[model samples]
Target: MKTCNNCGAQVEDVAKFCPECGFKFGSIAEPRAVVTDMYDHTSEFSPEDIANNKLYAILMYCVSLMGIIIGLLAAGDSPYVRFHIKQSLKLFICEVILGLITGALFWTVIVGIVGGIAIVVLAVVDIICLVNACKGLAKEPPIVCKIGFLK
Candidate 1:
């Protein structure tokens, strides 16, 4: 048996690609392997790949921009992208909930100063997280903005 480099799943030795994860295997030459390696590196994404994967990248770029369903769908077949998408979704949900609560408090009880301050803080944190995502970093949002329910 041979292990799939992508997902570490074992497959029959005669298999040219991993059945579970679809990772191709067994190149005949060093040049071919090098080309394969280049494509496998996520950080070295080409413009075409980025364009093709634009929805996935955008869904991952802002946790509060869309629903978790969209993020999950965009993250298809890529664990690294999925990780960021999931994290962003969690942060987005938290920001939404906080915004609603703060708005309600300000409008219903006239606690305008405190509610406005809370909203400002949440917006700043959300912007920071979005900026990080645009840079393709997988850093999680601040602790207060993360949804513990999913993690």
Candidate 2:
């Protein structure tokens, strides 16, 4: 039996979720490649750096512009925080550009549809970056990783 991390419910080892709280335990067969990609940067930084600057790194995504400023001011020397700040800054710039393009083309209904979809994509990328920061990993976020900004 395995204990559910979400609600402390006991479940069978083969179970994919917590029956009591609906928390996803995930499948044991999930691909290792996906997991590895997300945490591939774990060995790049010292645990001390990740532990000490995690909050500032998370802040970089939580508040965008202000978070960048705060992260730089409070944890300027932390490579982990710096990595996240650069990633978050790229996301911020992408959002700004998307918003401007959408606003300028709002008169066309097509722009609304395309903009809405783009916004969702950007949100997902932002979540990925935020999660990586919270996990103290410097994994570059998908899509955002290709953007050439804040380098």
Candidate 3:
């Protein structure tokens, strides 16, 4: 087992994310600064370009599929918009699957309530994603980002 840097949680050696805190495991133990550096070092895109698309990016978080459609149709040309839309789409799908599983488990009162709370917490994370987008981070939400693809 490996210890997660962010939360100090023990994870399976092959785990891609920290189950406790959702810290993404990169080749190096701590890659937060490295990733930011990589993005900052890029010369191709201007930060202002990302800042300009903040509205659509926030919409992507709040509107789910509708946000994705708008982002794809109107802001596809912008990488920042596309990135947030993809993350939003991922969250929407995750929510549906989670809802189905939780709904079935509702016979257990505690499980139902906990699952419902989890769903609401997940939704709240999207709000953080929205704020990040407005701030021009455009990074993935902690849990959704670590999940890696719709699977």
Candidate 4:
């Protein structure tokens, strides 16, 4: 078995992506071809793989924004898990920015409504992500896969 670089999980040699991390098996230390055409973005997740990592995927959504760290340090043993975690990571960044904005808004009680709205919006987003993860879907929100900076 080959070890996955992202989650350090052992994977079969014939696998392309890590069963836990979704990262290309052999390219652990190497950067991924993140900019490949959408048509070429094939990381077929088998039902067995999805079944194996479902819990990790759900944890990625339920653990607040820290789920991203959990994904990096622990989960991410499957492509489906990695996809959701990456999306959650991007959302966490947005959450941080929104939090800073919300903190500023708190000074003005009237305008602080925006903070509440942001909270609600993030919660809804989180729920949606959680559902998808539970389904073992590797489908990503637009921005998650679009950001090619991540190797």
Candidate 5:
């Protein structure tokens, strides 16, 4: 028997994923390279660029469209800030569209529930993007990455 690291549950040694949390184990488990790749964008910008513009990048996520404008004016030359601004822009647009849809369909209970959940998810993604900016990384946010308008 072995303990699953993810959920702290006991499992058979031969099992590939934890029964309690579905966490992959051993050789089949998620690879370090893939995990690193998911957040790796340091090579795209210089260290100085990341350091200088990280604050403006973070602001873009915190203040929505207004933050994007601030970031553009403050750190327009920084590739690092620009990257985060694009991610923030994508999220802002999605939020606007979701809000409009939910408002129009406010009469339906199902739309209200689903829209509320989606809004929560977008908020979480915004936090993720803000954290990435704080870390000086340019990782594209999940779900919002699929938006093709701003790229």
Candidate 6:
């Protein structure tokens, strides 16, 4: 038997995850063990990596405007870029659908006004995520997006 580092529960030595806290038993403690204050995993990125990969970072930010094409390109190597690209693709698709629906419902000043407002909000969020990406920060966008389908 071995004591789990996470919750101090006794578990079999052969167990992979702790029974009490589900912490992985052996390979290495989760990053949470070292960086306990933050809840987001993106925070684990090293600053040096972000600074050196500015091009990839910018590509991820611009993915919102280019849609799936750019997103697919960005997903090639860098996991950081891939994460942002996936998120931006989701937001872009949602915005497009919303634009179509609103245009159909109210093809006048009202839809334009509301849709424009929504676009601005999304743009600002994209900008923020982009800036964070540049800084090598693992920050997700404020917008709710689904990238589960992306590999």
The positional error of residue 73 in candidate 2, measured at the CA in angstroms, is: 0.6
lDDT of each: 0.60, 0.82, 0.77, 0.69, 0.85, 0.65
Question: TM-score for each prediction?
Answer: 0.50, 0.70, 0.65, 0.57, 0.73, 0.55
Each prediction's RMSD over C-alphas, in Å, is 13.5, 9.6, 15.2, 15.3, 10.8, 9.4
- Where model 3 places Cα greater than 4 Å from the true spot, the runs are 1-45
Question: Which pairs of residues have clashing backbones in candidate 5?
Answer: none
50, model 3: CA deviation in Å? 0.7
Q: Report the C-alpha lDDT of model 6 over 1-151, residue by residue, as the tens digit.
A: 9889888999998899997889887656544555543324466555555555556656656655664455456545656556666666666666787778677866688887888787788778778867876666765566543233432
Query: For residues 1-151, what per-residue lDDT tens digits would candidate 2 score against the true structure?
Result: 9888888889999888788998887643345654456525767889999999999878877889999999999888888788877778888989999999989997899998899799899988888888978888877768866664565
Location of the lowest summed lDDT over 10 successive residues in candidate 4: 142-151
Q: Give the worst 10-residue stretch by lDDT in candidate 5.
A: 27-36
Worst 10 residues of 1 by lDDT: 32-41
Q: Model 5 TM-score?
A: 0.73
Ranked by lDDT, top first? 5, 2, 3, 4, 6, 1
- Per-residue CA lDDT of candidate 1, range 1-151, in tens? 7677778898898888789977777653125433343112345444554445555655554534453456566546655556556666666676677777777776665567776776677667667766655655445566543345665
TM-score of 3: 0.65
Candidate number achieving the greatest TM-score relative to the actual structure: 5
Alpha-carbon runs more than 4 Å astray in model 6: 1-40, 46-49, 63-71, 108-112, 145-151
The segments of candidate 5 whose C-alpha lies over 4 angstroms from its true place after superposition are 1-40
lDDT of 4 by residue, 70-128 (tens): 76667556676676666777767767777888887787876578887867777787787
What's the best-to-worst order under TM-score?
A: 5, 2, 3, 4, 6, 1
Model 3 C-alpha lDDT per residue in residues 41-90, reported as the tens digit of each score: 12344677677777888888878888889888887998777677777888
Candidate 4 Cα outliers beyond 4 Å, as residue runs: 1-43, 109-111, 141-151
